[model samples]
Target: MFDILVIGSINADLVFISDIRPKAGETVMGKDFKVLPGGKGANQAIAAARLGKKVGFIGCVGNDDNGKKLIENLRGNNVETQYIQIVDDVPTGVANIVVAEEDNSIIVIPGANYSISKDMIDKNMDILLNSKLILLQNEIPMEVIEHIIDLCFGKDIKVILNPAPAVKLKESIVNKIDYLTPNEHECKIAFGNPNTDGLLTKYPNKLIVTVGDKGVLYHDGNKKVNIPAFKVDVVDTTGAGDSFNGAFAVAIVEGNSLYESLLFANKAAAISVTKIGAQEGMPYLEDLKGL
Candidate 1:
């Protein structure tokens, strides 16, 4: 069985890097533009696979050249793509990422990714049931994620939900997830402000707020744990959180304590930001050992 299974969107990222972000109806000369194979699911899968974990990906790709290219990329990286479905009518998902010196913005046209569903998950039931860790993100329909969670709810699988490009989700998912990984904004939108007093004493089983550069904060069942981020020269912050989740899952599967896992994951994410592309930036197990 694979150590980690990721169910989410797969997209070709067309990035435009500029010194500063553009305002509405204004155009400026761009500094750089590059296309890379990306998407949260694919990024996480590649991250774990390169770190020496057996990983599998389940997502939909359109019957197009980009789709075909992404499938090839995953296979070359040692991530199993047999469960990734191909949709006939819709085009492959595409994410237009605009990276400014200070921050970034993204607009995704889900395309075939929106077509990903529970039926597809059923077809890959054995794969889902056997994996040690199930990693999911909000890129897929929330209902589809809930369906998978319900199936693995009582089973031995541990569900790691990363709510990014953060949006509203139902209480069903909030109550059931074993671990919820959210960025600072997502944490505020999902729960209240992180600065709230006694946040751990409140509905403590659910969340882990990932604060970039600052580190991570978790409300464990009893106490809150603060995990600091490693210092590194950041090039592109894109996909850093995904790297964190992937490394965290792999560490957990290898039986590391939560503190150790968070530290290991933080280092992986720190290294990821120092490079440009998403999957291309992830540090391997040997690198992690040195960290």
Candidate 2:
């Protein structure tokens, strides 16, 4: 049985690093270029596995070299990849990323990620139900996410929804989620505004809004608390949120309270930004020492 099951997209990140972002219609040279394995789904799965959780991933990747490498990467991180499928016809998902002055902008080509279907979810129904918690993101199709949510509702399995690349969610679906983690921008898009009062009134303590550097604010039904981010020299902010979500799932599934989980996740994210690449920056359980 898995500690946390993540169902989302998988992609290869083509990253370009430079000192400054190029202006519109202008061409600029980058200092370095690399291709890294990434996807909201894969990143979170690896992040949790790195923290010693038995994480399983369910997603679609193209039947290609990138797919093989990504599978190897996940297996190397100790995540169960049995549920991952290699779809023919479609190419692997890819993200064209540019990092300038430590900030990044990305253009994602969904490719095989969009191939996630209802049949895939149904096929993995048993595996999905056997997990303690299910982690979801906006990378895959909404129908697939909704299907998974329907399966887990009232089944005693907890659900954590990280609405990245935010989309408007039905209240019926929102009410059923045990946790909702969204970054500042995502929160704004989902709710029209990121006013804490309005969001707290609606989501209560279930909402977690991650404000980069400023830290995270959470309302757990009782009260709202702002958990300050751990201070660190940031190298890349790409996978920081994914790291937080992954580590947070680990803590919650391990029976830690929400407050404690947030603190632990906060530290994990802080450590991630000090390194390069998304998965490369993730910290194991041993790395969470006196922050």
Candidate 3:
């Protein structure tokens, strides 16, 4: 049995850092470029594993060098990769990330990621049911996500859905998820409302919104609470949200109160931005001691 199960996308991030973003049909010089292992699913699995939780990842990758490296990277980070599949013809998913002037834009080619079918989940049903908590994201298919959530209903298993790359979800699906985590922008898109405060109040403890720099916000069943983010010099904002989601799952599984879990997650996310790479920047259990 695993402490955490992540059923989502795994990709190799092609990152480019440049001073100025070029206009349409133009080229510009870049300061740096690196290929790193990333994807909402893989990053969160590594984050939870680094934070001292046993994590299992289930996703699809193409049969290529990048795919092999991603699986190896997950293993190196102590995430179980046996459930990950290597598809025959599809190319591995990749995100082209351009970081310029303190902000970043991303374009994703979800090649093999889109190949994750309901059949895959059915085959892994035992692993899914055995895990204490399951983490999900929008990088995978909506139908598969809904299928998994429906399967876990009444099973006493917890689910954390990070609605990134957001799409509006059905009320039935939203009501079924145990925790709904979205960044400020995603929250608006997912719920189809501009009134963020009203949405938080509507869901209470179930809806947790991560407002960058300003920290996190949620309703505690009685009142609104904002957990302040730790003060730190941020280098790159990539994967910081994933770190928060992963750490929050670990904290919740360890039986921490909602407030305490948010604090712990905030500390983890703050620590992640202090470094450059997504998976590389995630702090281990010991790294949280002084912070």
Candidate 4:
């Protein structure tokens, strides 16, 4: 059985480093450009794998050079890619990422990612059930994500939903998820409330929010706890949240307490931003030793 199974998107990240973000109808010179393998699903999978967990991925990519390289990259990082499908017609998903002022803004073209349907999840039910924990993101179709959460309800598996590119979630969906990792903006959108502390209290240990550089926050039944992020020289902030979710999954599965898990995740995220790319910046188990 897999320690963690990520049911999410896989994409090629097209990164451009610029001094400033140009306004609409304006063009500006970028300092650098690079193509990197990323997707919330793939990045999380790689994150867990790097941390010494047995991770598997369930997603789709187009049958092309990008798709082939993405699969190869996953394997190189020790993520199990047997369940990833390659479709004929569509191109692999891609994100246009612009890194400016040490932060990133992205535009996603979810090509093959949108091909993930409820039927695909149904066909992979055994893989889904075999995992101890499942990681999800909003990059794929909403119905498919809802279907997986519904399928895991009352079952032994735990679900961590990272509501990126945020969308409103039903209360029923929230009730079924074991963990909800949302950034400040996503938290506001998902629950339709700007009062973050109130929401944290409502969900208790269930709601974990990542506030960049400041660290992570969650309510622990009786009280609210904030796990401060480690201090580091920041480079690219891409995939930092994905890194946290992946490391958090490993820590949880390994029987760490809620506080310990968040600490571990916080460190992982801090390390991720010290480098230049998404997957390229993910830390390994060895990288965590000194910190």
User: Which structure among the candidates has the greatest lDDT?
Assistant: 4
Candidate 2 TM-score, true structure as reference:
0.97
Q: Please provide, for model 3 over 263-288, each residue's C-alpha lDDT reduced to its tens digit, 9 standing for 90 to 100.
A: 99999999998877788789998888
Q: Looking at model 3, which ten-residue stretch has the lowest summed lDDT?
A: 97-106
Cα lDDT, model 4, residue 132: 96
Residue 276 in candidate 1, Cα distance off native in Å: 0.7
TM-score for candidate 4, residues paired by index: 0.98
For residue 163, what is the lDDT in candidate 4? 94
Best by TM-score: 4
Which residue pairs come into collision in candidate 1?
A: none
RMSD from true fold, candidate 4: 0.8
Best-to-worst ranking by lDDT: 4, 3, 2, 1
How should the candidates be ordered by TM-score, best one leading? 4, 3, 2, 1
- The digit string of per-residue lDDT tens for model 1 on 244-274 reads 9899889888988777888888989988888
Q: lDDT of each prediction vs. the true structure?
A: 0.85, 0.90, 0.93, 0.95
Against the true structure, what is each candidate's TM-score? Answer: 0.94, 0.97, 0.98, 0.98
RMSD (Cα, Å) of model 3? 1.0
